[model samples]
Target: MPVDFTHPWVGRTVIYTAAHPNARPEQGIVTSVNVEARIVFVRYGAGTTSKATSVDERLQFLDGSDLILWK
Candidate 1:
């Protein structure tokens, strides 16, 4: 369930999911994919902490459902 770097994820728009299902989902664009560490970096806005991650539990892909939902 790690981030699927095999997909051309960079530059693609995505919805950043929160732990609470009802919480608002922040929208962002994929910036980088670290295949070595299985981390997918996303930029939500122009700020230092804007580069968020689309991962969870160290080995799970938090945006997998988002990818399918958006697709």
Candidate 2:
């Protein structure tokens, strides 16, 4: 399913499920949304090792097939 870029998804919590088993389930808050690019930035996981860890990821809505939004 295509992502509704106009919808206010920012600040909402979401889960990302990948097709690969190695890709662990990611739970995070929607940090940013790029409507033009159809990509949502999510900040997930805790930085246990350092404060400068880059945990934020850019997720593309692939027909709404890989993302699950928490109501």
* Best prediction by TM-score: 1
| Residues forming the 10-long window of minimal summed lDDT in candidate 1 | 54-63
Write down the lDDT of every candidate, Cα atoms only: 0.55, 0.50
TM-scores for every predicted model? 0.55, 0.51
- Compared with the true structure, what per-residue lDDT tens digits does model 2 show for residues 1-71? 34443567666666665667688766666665555444666667662321111223334343443443342
Worst 10 residues of 2 by lDDT: 47-56
For candidate 1, list the clashing residue pairs, or say none.
Answer: none
lDDT of the structure predicted as candidate 1: 0.55
In model 1, the runs with Cα more than 4 Å from the true position are 1-7, 45-71
lDDT tens readout by residue for model 1, 1-71? 34454568777776665677587666766766666454567777564443646354222234455332122
